[model samples]
Target: MKDLIILWLSGGNDAWWSVLVAMGNPWQVLDLGAVLALIVVGMQIAVATCLPDRLWADDGTNAFFSQLSYLHIFLLMALTALAEEIFFRAAIQSLLVEWLHSVAAGIAVPAAIFAVAQRARPASCASASRAAPATASSWG
Candidate 1:
């Protein structure tokens, strides 16, 4: 639903393809994505360990995901990665090049937007729980 709106916002551009096409290095892209994901998770772990529990994910966010099965989790992960990369990274990377007149701005702006947007709230996430959910994944 939101992906459709974002694609429309990009003036019908299929940036998912364009970004991949322009990048021209599949291995590197995959490696970068993996490294970035690992780094983010590591950082989150560090934050969780070191910081006081001053801030937290909305409890609803935890409850919502907890209800999903392994299949649902897999689907959510795949769809989220694909949809977000296309709209936020691909679309912004190209459009910003033209509008902002700087490659850095193009990359940075969208990256910030993506981060802030994700943190803002998970739509339909379990209702404002501060604690991280239990580790028992649906598959387990």
Candidate 2:
């Protein structure tokens, strides 16, 4: 994929596994915290879905995705995840860490960039933040 190409070009091809770890570890068992987090997230989603559209506007994202076939949707989601992990974590973050000589700088700088870029496109970060209000409502 283009992400791998970018990583290779950045001289980070050898560290690709680091980005895979960021994506997630398939071998790791889910801990209590992970299970609890999933439960809380599911509850948040359920509550959010029950809310009226007036409180949480549709924003046409669901409408757009609704038009896609299930296979297309799955592929889109998978490829997007892979691309983001490789480009951001492997390429950009790795480059930043090497250049800045600070692991914290590497993580923080790419995260900020990702946040801004996601806001501009209203796709990645927006989806994650969509659950945020649901979380607040649950606490209230």
Candidate 3:
């Protein structure tokens, strides 16, 4: 978690720097707003497209909204994307570019690190799910 947070802050700082360099106006409110808006829209599109049918499929008795509000889900997705982009794309990769002076190396290094970091959670979840039935049968 701490590593992730550090990555995010660094990414945000790098993103700010990149914008400053490209626009020569770091403090431009409009540019900042546009960047944020783009992030949100991108997130929404990704979610809408990637979500499982069980979660978003049309059924006459669909209870998705009742079970989990759209706002809550949106907030979760936004926060995750913001954190990931900031840490992996902005901060770590930017640092790597500065160190190696190679764009491909910079991007690859952080991407690999991010992929490893992300795999931990899902791997653990899968292991736990696989063990669940065995544990239940042992109790019976």
- The TM-scores, one per candidate, come to 0.49, 0.54, 0.45
Ranking by TM-score: 2, 1, 3
Compose the digit string of candidate 2's lDDT tens values, residues 1-140.
Answer: 34445776899845664644554644432453476679998999998989766566455578898899999999997999999999999999999999999988999999999998776955665676676545446543
lDDT scores of the candidates, listed in order: 0.72, 0.75, 0.70
On TM-score, who's better, 1 or 2?
2
Query: Candidate 3, overall lDDT?
Result: 0.70
Highest-scoring model, TM-score: 2
- lDDT per residue as tens, model 3, 16-132: 334445565546646666877899989999999998654552332346556768888788778999999998888899999999999879978898898898876666656665666
Candidate 2 segments exceeding 4 Å error: 1-37, 121-140
lDDT of 1 by residue, 17-40 (tens): 455455677885687679779999
* Candidate 3 clash pair list: 7-87, 11-91
Worst 10 residues of 1 by lDDT: 130-139
> Sort by lDDT, best first: what order?
2, 1, 3
Model 1 spans > 4 angstroms off: 1-63, 122-140
In terms of TM-score, how similar is model 1 to the real structure? 0.49
Worst ten in a row by lDDT for model 3: 53-62
